[model samples]
Target: MLYLFQQILNGLHMSALYALLAFGYALTNGVVRRTNLAYGALFAFSGQTMILVAVFGWHVLWLTLPATVALGILAAFAYAALVGAILARSVFARLAIRTPNAIVVATHGVALMLMEIGRIASETRDFWLPPLLAWPVVFASQGDFRATLTVMQLINVGAILLVLISATIALERSRFGQRWRAVCDDPKAAAMCGVDVPAVFRHAVLAGGLAAALAGILTALHFGNVSFGTGLVFGLKILFVTAVGGYDSPPRAAAGAAIFGMAETLWSGYFPIEWRDAAVFLGLVALLVLRPGHEETRVAQP
Candidate 1:
């Protein structure tokens, strides 16, 4: 029973992570109709930038928890926006009129470049955050077993879910959301109707960048640090995870990613941890192959 309860807590953390990740990816891809694989690298890079800032005396400004969190969020978003802008200009620019596939292929190179930049910027130093909010909070207790989770876990999960919900609302009801969907359905038509296609693209990337930044920040805060080399693997995992959920809708994709996260956490809990990644990857691959979703089912126009 205790194990069951603990697994639920563990799954909650992972579910939040994957949900935010999927929403971030879908935010851009669903609207832009182009996959920016550099997104994962941007995510890692943003977190690295925040850590580098802290290591360089920014931590001195941590006068209070709210202050620290606000500064951290600002740092994350700043770096993400910087990277996103660069990618938008260099790799993602003019794709609608030029060649869409070129941009998709270019994102691979951009991802590698960002990873190298992150590695070089780190200077081979570890940027582990001093543990924050480490106190455990108990939920329920048995005679000898207690269901507990860390304060960081609760904060991370709550904050991520909140962002996800807020983004969903924005996408569904806001003017930008209306424009985003308009662009998604038909960019040429959207443009003809006064939707600034370029601006829409930029906004989508920035929105996605913010989402990725938040995810990276939370993961780093919870796990101590994220490796500079983790961007590719993280990107691939998120790519497949979001694929499982389909890219047509942000909310549905988030739900799918959440389900994958919970399943992964449970598998890790009951099985050999060493094989968990392999098993999860293989399972996701098998599912993707057997049932191709929106991206796969779409008939490309020539």
Candidate 2:
């Protein structure tokens, strides 16, 4: 029973992390109409950065929270402006004029380039980030049936909740949010009404990048380690959550993240860790098979 409880808590923590990444990915995809395979690289980059910073004996490790998020936002903005622009000018523009396959190939090519770059930069270092907090909360009591919660985990949950709430409020009440909604609703109409569609997209990409970077930092703090390939699985998981959750809704993405997190956690605990990928993939397959064409619904305004 205690083992079960521990597993459950672990699952919740994992789910929250995945939800954060999913939310970021969904936000960008919702606005840009393009999927970012490089999204996960932000996590890997932030984690690696955090680890390196910590190793330098800098007191700034304590400031990783905000710094990591800022890094994420900056990286996202740069990647979107640079890579996204190149795609827009070279491949996407050609595709718009000729064949849609150009867009697909271009985006995939960008993803490949990003992955290779990350691999080369990260190498095979098993980097570690010092824990953000000490002490773990015990949530259950039984013969070895204990569930422990870390301060970092709690912070992660709080951070995600805050992001979701803030995003919701901004979208519902702010002018920029309104403009974003308008752009999403009808880009042509929004542009006609003087909304800057490109600016809106840039902001969206920035938000997504920041979110991914934050998630990576938090994940590093939580797990105490980072690797170049870490973002690969994370990217896939975000894609899964976005697909399962209504891709347009942040709340739904969170929900899907929780579900996926819990499933992966529990399965990993009970079965071989190697099966984690297979389990997650199976779950995604089940969801898709059960709800074919569900994502076709129009995105709801905040």
Candidate 3:
């Protein structure tokens, strides 16, 4: 029972991160109808930059605790937003409409370039960060064991909930939501009706990128280290989540992520950890083979 409770808590935190990351992918795909593979790169970039800022504060800037933490967070968000905007405008916006294969190749190139940059910057090594909030809260009790929630995990849940709920409400009630629906349903008609199709697409990518960045930072903090290879793993997991969730709905993405996190966590706990990812990949492949056209039928709407 204690093990079950602990796994459930862990699953919830992991699920939140996966949901946010997958939602970012879904957001971009909704607008341009193309997957921005570079999203994982952006996720890694934000996390790496956050770590770099902290390192600079400690070694180079000689800053106090508060200053270091603030600077690191600010740097993370600023870099994520700026790079997201620039990439959306320069790369995704221009190529997403031109050729399907072109955008895929271009985004993959962008992802590789970012990964290489991370490698060089970190001197071909992994980067670690001290947890911003390491305190844990007791949640459950059993014979000689207690379940606790770390501050970071609680923050992860809060952040995901706040962002997802606010975004959903805003998309449902605001003028921007109407514009987004207009574009998603039919870009040509939306443009004819005075909707800025390109601008909508750009916004979608930027929004998705920022969400991915936040997820990356939280995930790195949870794991206590950030690696260059983590981005690709995140991208692949979120890809599976988006596919299973049905790209048309963010809520469905969250649901899929919850299932994924629970299954992955339970599997790792019960089996050899080395085979965890292989199991997930095989499961994803099986799911794809079983339901090849599930996503095609569920149309996107406001």
User: Any runs in candidate 3 off by more than 4 Å, and if so which?
Assistant: 292-302
Residue-wise C-alpha lDDT for candidate 1, range 101-217, written one tens digit per residue: 776788888888877877887886777877889898998898878888999999999999888888889988999999888777777788888888788777887788888888888
Report residue 136 deviation for candidate 3 (angstroms). 2.2
Q: Comparing 2 and 3 by lDDT, which wins?
A: 3
Cα lDDT of candidate 2 equals 0.68
Q: Over 4 Å off in model 2, which ranges?
A: 57-104, 143-145, 292-302
- Error (Å) of candidate 2 at residue 202 is 0.5
What is the C-alpha local distance difference test score of each model?
Answer: 0.79, 0.68, 0.78
Give the TM-scores of the predictions, in the order they appear. Answer: 0.91, 0.80, 0.93
Candidate 3 residue-wise lDDT, 144-194, digit = tens: 798888998898899898998888887789888788777777777888888
In model 1, which range of ten residues has the least summed lDDT?
293-302
Question: Candidate 3 deviates by what RMSD?
Answer: 2.6
Question: What is the descending TM-score order?
Answer: 3, 1, 2
lDDT of 2 at 33: 50
